[model samples]
Target: MNPLNLPFDSDAMLEGLRPWIECESPTWDAGAVSRMMALAARDLADAGAEVETIPGTGGFGDSLRASFPHPDRGRPGILVSGHMDTVHPVGTLEKLPFRVEDRLAYGPGIMDMKGGNYVMLEAMRQILRAGLQTPLPVTFLFTPDEEVGTPATRGLIEDAARGQRAVLVPEPASADGGAVIGRYAIARFELLTEGRPSHAGWALKDGRSAIAAMARKILEIEAMTTEDCTFSVGVIHAGQWVNCVSSECRAEVLSMAKTQADLDRGVAAMEALQGEADGVAFTVTRGVTRPVWEPGPGTMQLYDLAKGLAADIGFQLGCGSAGGGSDGNFTGAMGVPTLDSIGVRGKGLHTLTEHIEIDSLAERARLAAGLLMNIR
Candidate 1:
């Protein structure tokens, strides 16, 4: 039975989300992100939650954990997880702007997660208002650095998952309103090439072009993409002068693995490519790593439960896979049951066109509230 039938206010949810979206909490801007977290913490507190603040990597903003105790003491419950950071920069709002048109709320971070966060907050409020008795305690973990792979809050998430029944990640749902089941294991890499520099016009033969070597390595790494693994050279930096032979070059490569074993094998292959370029020494430095959330029994169980809840709430639920990673990857990798993309219905994540279906705010809140009160 849907406890929150006609109880959620979609207009109120969007109004509440306005200040948060206007806050502009880019991951790199620590102070800005922290401010955003504070606002959310206050809202959670007002909604009968006790918010705990954990200082994050000094300048990259802090994390928040909000717990609703109520009467469920011995029973374990859900860890509602998400990130406050958006890929958009501080001034992005001036261009993209926040507005409602044709039932879509357009803005930076609106689709990627701000709308989802609002849905979560509203759901909890509805659950409390409905006086629903849940056998489990609901815990909310908001990280400031998930856009960068949760480097600052990975341990925090895993620790919060301890003895919990499940982790619910409210990343934006598919534009078609599908829930996320499995995600590609993700890794970041910085590949650097070192070579001797010489004047391009005078002694081209004497110089070993680091830029050329980096280009070749980028191709080799990009060629590794297949049915199970994806490699992308997202960024490359080399050379200052057009005349001088570039001596130092760097490339930022992102790898997505369909399986953990595939991730390992891909890394080994990339490592082997080091020093393969003539006269260029290669160095590979790994950044953040998130394991694949393979669909296990627990995952499918959660999916089925969600589908049942959706039907009960007067809607049907669909499940899908994601190429990106989030805190869901952390808990899913830890073998704890995790489900994601269970947020506002939206599309164009991390882009200027990012927006969410305004109507889904109420629907998502009802669905999430139902899951919270029912899922074991």
Candidate 2:
């Protein structure tokens, strides 16, 4: 069933991936993420690819662009996109160390992305060892801020994707080992509430609580969720001292919609919430956003190619849309064919229990190698 006949050992692959998992490259820690990017850059350069490290801006980590040499190196070719940053903060390894239990491999950022990114690298290494060149040149773009909607690297991702033949994202595969052909629109908002602070015991009636006002607004925003759109306030901060009425409170809000129109309406509703609440001043500031990407003919065709490759590797690859947008959203929205979530299959992304099915490493690497060798 193996079309490429490339030798792959799951155990060896996991061993190679262990270092990546151990390196905690959280999005907010620029130095930590840069170290991770440096590791990747070394591997890419050693693999005979021309690597370029693009420094990060806005307090983010550096990005990498690696291009493989081909007769048509300058022509349109395949672009592989992935993120080096993760949601897990540093020191997570102390509690969630990289370990293998039965068929699952556990670690911070393993299943969500490091596992998939490693698999792609292995695929490329195998292809090179086999002394074969792909039909088209391959380029790898690893960014450092995808976990936070790529606040600093969106332009780099889009610029690299433009004029490319196709884009492939190695985000964790779907629950059923499927690939993503479309993604929903996503919007982020920052909410702030400021109120008059007073001594809790001395001026209980006169004091206005910012936390209370923020809590009410959070409930109101979450209640706006519908089948077509969803909303959640994930982060909140308020009240430095317990004895005093809170003077300021802030929260981060996230909204996802199946369509751009629905997201527009949601944004309008969120922005309209900026007003006075019982002497508390409330404001909503819009943040980064990902546009909706619906499957087009080119995307379907790319998926079809991947499906055939998966079948040759002894699996049926299904295609569907997904939430939690990836870099594919940018390329897909730009009318370039994109296939996402073609990485290792696993569960519990962004949690302490995050892990990947150990067996999916070799299996998915074969699929990735096939795509690299056959895609024209």
Candidate 3:
């Protein structure tokens, strides 16, 4: 069935998008994020979902788990994944308030995902109005910490995904407007260097520059990048005083690999790294990890299912992997049939210019609803 053939009023979807954009829910702001969850919970309940608010860890706000049962009362269900938090902080809307111009809707979190989150809401709304019964049960998880690596909600996501038939993530579409079929294993690490400090003019010979040591390590890490494996030093901090050889330096390394062998290869190499200079020593600390989500047979089969649904709506759907991690990584790694980026096609996801194509709303809603109803 073509969900686009169903009634989808673009203006009405915007009426829903306006208030959600106005409610800024950054990852760290518990109050703001909880408020956003409350608003979404109300609508989910109105759409006939059984909603539950799970408390977050360490005061990071709460996550919403909403469920809709099939008419036949199925046991296992399909999981719809999303997040309320965004990279933008509070009051960003004051500078870039929600506005639609030239068929583009611009706002904080609009594409990076509140746009995707709204797709789930609007899809459920359409399904409820039509009174269509799903063949399998459905679960929608609105996590609070996806932008920050899903740290707080990682276990929650995995637990909810357990025994589910398939997992679908409504993350933003690819730059080329494709669905996410695979995801790279996200390996984050921090490099810390300690060395001797000395006066630049008089005791320069006594100094062992930590910055110099880190620069060498930086080259070493960057050289590990291959056509299939990617690595980058995203953040670096070194000497503060211009006249002194700094004693400390630090850097954040982000690496991605498509296969487990490559992920292990990169991780082992970093863990074995030591300072090249005698007086300059280094420490490598492993940070958060989202295991690489290589599309399995199950996942590929799910993509074929969604591809057919996209064609039903009059569009060709392509699939690819991303370097960034999502809650889908946890579920996908758990052996569930996972498909991601089934949301609005847009540009500038994490930038100030983030916006979605105004027309993607209707089509993506059609696709999402079709998946929900047709995922038997």
Question: What's model 1's overall lDDT?
Answer: 0.86
Clashes per prediction?
A: 0, 0, 0
Model 2 over residues 1-376: C-alpha lDDT tens digits?
Answer: 2335799889999998998899999999999999999998988888788999999999999999999878899789999999989999999999899988989999999987988888988888888877878889899999999999988999999999999889989999998889999999999999999999999988877889999999999999999999889999999998888889998999999899999999999999999999996899999999999999999998998999999988878899998999888889999999999999999999988999999999999999998988888777
TM-score of each: 0.94, 0.98, 0.90
lDDT at 200, model 1: 99
lDDT of 3 at 46: 88
The C-alpha RMSD of each candidate to the native structure, in angstroms, is: 2.0, 1.2, 2.6
Residues 1-376, candidate 3, lDDT per residue (tens digit)? 4455778876778788888888999999999999999999998898888999998786798999998856654478888889999888998988778999998999999998988889888898888788777778888999898876777788888988898888989999888778887888888898999999999998999999898888888998899899777889988988778999889999999888878898998898889895456888899999888998878988888889889988888899999878788888888888898999998889987778989998898889988888887787
Greater lDDT among 1 and 2 belongs to 2
The best candidate by lDDT is 2
User: Lowest summed-lDDT stretch of 10 residues in model 1?
Assistant: 1-10
How does residue 255 of candidate 2 score in lDDT?
95
Off by over 4 Å in 2: 1-3
* Regions of candidate 3 where Cα sits further than 4 Å from its true position: 1-3, 69-74, 197-212, 237-245, 276-278
Candidate 1: list runs displaced more than 4 Å.
73-75, 200-205, 241-243
